[model samples]
Target: MLGAIIGDIVGSRFEFNNHRSKAFDLFTDNCRITDDTIMTLAVASAIMEAEEQLESAAEIGDNNREYYRLVEVLAVKTMQNLGRSYPNYGYGDRFAQWLSSDQPKPYNSFGNGAAMRISPAGFAAKTETEARILSEVITRVSHNHPEGLKGAEATVMAIYMARNGADKQAIRDRINGYFYTLDFTIDGIRDTYRFNETCQETVPQAITAFLESTSFEDAIRTAISVGGDSDTLAAITGAIAEAYYGIPENIKEKALTYLDTNLQAIYEAWQEFKKKRSMNITFRPAKLQEREILFREGYREWPKNRTFEEYCSDNAKEDEYGIRYIMAIDDEILSSVILLELKSIMGKKVYGIGSVLTPQNHTGKGYATTLLRKCLQQIENNDPLIFLYSDINPAFYQRLSFRILPLEFQKVKKSTCMVRCRDENWEALLKSSVALIPDYF
Candidate 1:
């Protein structure tokens, strides 16, 4: 739940006394992702087939201690990274105690801590039912109470609905449908929030905030407006809302400002982790595999196309097409761009690879070769016939399994090459340059 961490970090400042509304900021100088974000990631990382992490931890390395030690290491590292020098965000009393502890002592405090901190289960769950089950199982680690378990379950449900493309009403219905045992209406929460303090009351209330939202940011505002555990409430709601609306551009830009340099990098790490995780996940060990092999292939003469370098670097942050990649060195940008959207070409059933660039001085380094091989390695299924057109050297792509075809091959329906690279294909020539994004204003 990277989105939740971002929300928590951004909303931490306004948690208790929220004044600003609908403002897009990564994290206000005062804001930082809390135990919710850290614990959520840990839970997502710890998942195994055995019905429980504690059980799995107990059975590790022919003994249980290794697993516990591993879990403790992850928790400590995540919590340590949450402080000032890294992400530098907010944390409540019980969490601070856990963070400061050299070893994790199961604390029985069943506050919203368990619920507010669990969003990754939504992403990790294979189905809605599985998500709810995982939510209950994981929350029991520290928060054994029914309310604690309920709060975590509700967060998982919200995250699952949002990621699966459910609208606000759909999310609300799913949340309310399962949480019928609790007084779950927005009005009910707002009316009784003055007296509600436990996980049961707060979790559903936070989710309702998202369920009633019009925009991603609106969910956070709704959570804060109700006023109970404002930051934690918004953290849960904002995370689900972000998955629904997809983080707004202005908000993403501003949020990065509040984080120190290390955590700013952590944002990139989170993106990479999620991207690779989605690509690699399968049911059994026999299915587990790494499909893609991406290489940056750093540049020496980066200034030859300085603007292109900056542009490619900026576009790399949002691999929107899910197949686009850029070349960079250290923090400085570079001059290679390959933004190929791996979709089919109508009738021909050919795999398309249009985003190809070999700008100025960077030409001889075999970027095309490097990128092509990497792309092929990444394809485990579906993208069978790779296509591209190159007159300068058909031999280059030919080495990478691409074949040269006649100009009229477009009309011939061949499934071989990745692209029918036309001389007029200026959009494909440069990186990050899109000639046709129909309604993109």
Candidate 2:
């Protein structure tokens, strides 16, 4: 249900992808969350309060609509709190002031803001009829335009239809009446959508993704394949998909790692809400990757070593796995040192954990640490175990909540040409095992 918000946070940076490839990341230390996240969380807070207020109102037999109105008030207030708390979380200039104080102005700005942030309320509604109604009411607080209302209403309704197990066409037919005129079905979307933006274009496009899928993950991939705002589209789609398909145990499990303690708590609250609705299936009992496959692709046989020029030339190859990583650029040159995603030595399926580096003069300003958290959040999988080679200073890792593992424990039971591959003396070499997590980054 919250997958929509997660999508926005993960996709915030690539809204206008330019020429970069999706293969570029998961980790590195650059990508960051944006206002879509701020606003979505704002809505979630409002929904939680709405639920509480609704129960309170029901006890007194107050009008049913009053409960949703309470939610609208809380939503505006929560959005305002986010502005004051994290002004730099990337709220656009015009909206930032609205988030700062009580005196407010709801924007006529018909951006996807309404659609992206409204998923939470949609899923929170008790029924399809109720979902559409709340969509209209909640949206009026900010996005009151016809198209804006349509976009937000469309997303919430899709999530409602999906959770109830309505088929793709059934859901499509329901919303198509309100938005665009299209005999064009979800299948048409699968066949036609190549790439586009704007809520008018992407919202319906993302809706088809949910309409066409069987699993939450599939819905995400479907949206990603068409491109556009991959994260946002996937997010908007994923929220609905989660309602229909539920998060696969695999994705939800892995997504857990990316969440810091605070995010984790929020996720748990979301789960509690879902449990009240229906049983959800997910990818549980996470799988382990093949060891042989690891030996082949990992650092062992350093891929036909290529210089920077050669590496840059193979853009497609970079997207495949380890080739593309974040870089700090300054003026016309590459600034700061790079954080390499060298092969990971962590538990099976834990993937890679490399260095956390800041470009040259970017040191004391906290850019590297900020980047590390952002990048880590991007790729934090749910394998439950992640290990990394400490950047020379073990102290750095220690600060990030990592405890030093004894070097003797990591050594391979077998040796290479009579030499131990895992250095028994590794602990003597540097600092702690994991790095400290910075406060807000």
Candidate 3:
């Protein structure tokens, strides 16, 4: 949804006059947030209101279909209200007439407006079926035509696929199989394309622009360069681009400046709702019941000559001190790290970092980095010397200021003992036989 808004603002200046090339400044003084952005936020606000109603109705045992019906009514009402609030914004003539009328009705038009404001449906739904349902409910209020519905549904499905880790080829193939033919390229259509408002003429070209692009900004550039219905085209492309390649922070900051206070407030509220929905991943110490889970993570980190149960039972004793930390999203553990306290050797207790493990599927998302930072903070008061043996991903720990110890101090020549501390005795501690250094990365 934010992607749609950003794209609308960036492409607003070139909506009527076409830009033939992809080389143009994204946000400019001539740029403005158009009806697409206003309507998108209106839909998002309606969804948020509907979610609140669903929560209240769920307590009274209302059926799910009843909740959807309420959402449909609220969506229409919200769009009408927001449309009235911004009278002079760039709305289509028919849409402007509908907005001012006491009886605003679906116009059975196959315009691209349906595709521009349907991103929230994709982001909020948990499944493809739910996405289709939400798309129909939201789109039918204004665009009742089949092409309009198809355009909105396709946009939602593309975002759903991209958000769930689908690649570009997979997205293109699925979209092609489900809806229109996407075999055409942006370059093939860029030169000859003209101002087009119909969903059939605009949505597929916008998607093709995304399919041919390298980054989020490039996708928006490609969409605008096609020249027809630039704001809406870039909006459709931006929605998909946001799901696949996240908007850079600087770009997001600049885009938000174009919106007024009311729209920005709605955007902020929607952001908070998204944050609430994504509150699954958390950090905490391992409980006694999860001892086996923690140990299994450790076993994957160090697959030595021992059964899984044996390794778990051996490490279960660490529960007494409660030093085992795991980063779990829901019931599944994604990463684990341990902070083991050593005995007072030279009148000061030392700490050993161990088992910095991240599962294969959950790598490259910073799970291990988050766990390591938390472990360090948990022991920051002691100012203890943190030591670890990292055979894999040594550069990660090195970036966090862990220095490699001498080769003679290591248990194996290939293995490395790394230390991190404010104290000077870390090097001396690494030389001791009780080092029990790390052997896995």
Candidate 4:
């Protein structure tokens, strides 16, 4: 939601003094990321944290609503926590009260605050119904009014539609069919519009700004020029605009400068979470029926002298978890794979990473690095000395913290044996003569 945050910062200076025109500096020294930006990030953080918890939960039992309930709790608590840290960042009166209260309860108000921070709900949810539910969860914590909930749901649904490749007419039809009327244009509202905080008065105006604009910056300018609750209006408009136009890189970089460390950390974490979530890749072992496809794909990466049947016979076997850890896209197509072999050398556990392969198409996208990180984390818990033989690309493994053993200590002459061992385990692993697997190398 960089678009929404950029809009918030750009419009922050014009929130009170009505601009009434689009011709103005987008970024000024006076502009700052306000409650809209903080609370939007807070919503994203809460949703991500709730998702992680849901994934970690051993059992959902029978109550599927438990997932939404957990998200609701996190949304409310995280908003309050972040709000306290950014106490001076222009919160609405009712929201400010809710944030400070020991037993915080939602005030039945249809404030624009609900719509301004609901962008994350749109991005995180997989379906329209899920987006609606998440928006309601985030909105009702402070703005519990029906109009407030409607505004939040409509904003999120618009973003979800745009993100999923819906046209502007579809977004307009959906928003108008569900929540506020988009009967007015940004130009029509500019001269006469006054500062308004209620969702009914503000949400429609914000939608019109996005509907009439040609670019993301144009959308923010259109929202701000209307001169009614400028920051929140632009935030709501920019959320939709971002999904449609994709904010410019320079604008995103400039907007990030306005955020404090706390907000920046949450934004970065949310970005990383979104990136991983969007990969649509899974790590698993080859099934009995798909063994041939796996072998064919593996052969494409490393076309050695071995036949496909021989490759299948070799990698078809499994480790303790019965997984060869193939990183596959769409379950049938293999993008990368890592063969794991664990052994006991000199009374110490040792893990060997071998047969690391990523097809030509997926070579530079860090899929190998992703697998390496996952394998390293799994090994670190058991305190094993990890080693890998990278004959094809030693530099790639070296970049991932695998260090080459000294020439005097090297047992393999054809390939480099790089090891990643803890400082304490380094001396012990080096002292053992049997730790090096010459055949595997």
lDDT of each prediction vs. the true structure?
0.53, 0.54, 0.79, 0.77
**Segments of candidate 3 deviating more than 4 angstroms:** 56-63, 281-441
Measured with C-alpha atoms, the lDDT of residue 439 in candidate 2 is 12
For candidate 2, what is the TM-score? 0.55
Measured by TM-score, the strongest candidate is 3
lDDT tens per residue, model 1, 1-441 = 656766676557666665433445535456766555655555655543232444531143322344445543444455444532323345656656666666656577668877766776676554455566667656665676776777778788778656654445445555656663434556555645653447876777777777677887777666766765666777788778877778777777766665556655655555665664445322111111211112223222222355655645643442455344444333222233343444443322334454355445344433344444445444423423445534245555543434454343332232222242322332232332222211110
What tens digits encode model 3's per-residue C-alpha lDDT throughout 1-441?
889988898899999888989899998899999999988988898878988876752221122577568768988889889999998888889888877888879999789999998999888764455677889989998899999999999999888767755556557766787789987877887888889899889889988888888999999998899998999999999999998889999999999998878888999999998887557977887666776766665687776788887787666655544387888878788788777876555555567787677778676555676577667766655656667877776777764557777676666655677877653566556556644444332
Better of 2 and 3 by lDDT: 3
- Candidate number achieving the greatest lDDT relative to the actual structure: 3
Give candidate 2 misplaced runs (Cα > 4 Å): 18-32, 54-63, 182-197, 274-441
Q: What is the C-alpha RMSD of each candidate to the true structure, in Å?
A: 16.5, 23.1, 13.5, 19.3
Give me the displacement of residue 322 in model 1, in angstroms: 29
Relative to the unseen true structure, what is the C-alpha lDDT of residue 111 in candidate 4, on a scale of 0 to 100?
88
TM-score preference between candidates 1 and 2, better one: 2
Query: What's each prediction's TM-score?
Result: 0.51, 0.55, 0.66, 0.64
Candidate 1, residue 193: Cα displacement in angstroms equals 3.0
Summarize candidate 4's per-residue lDDT along 1-441 as a digit string, tens digits. 878898899989998887988899999899998999989988998888887887843222223588789888999889989899889999877789989999998889898899999999888765555777888877888789999998888889888767755556546766776687788787776778899998989888888899889899999988888997999999999999998789899899989999878778888998998787667677665565665665677776666678877776676563342345666667744344555556665556777787676666555444565565555655655656667776777877654556787776676677788876555666766665643543452
By TM-score: ranked, best first: 3, 4, 2, 1
Model 1 TM-score relative to the real fold: 0.51
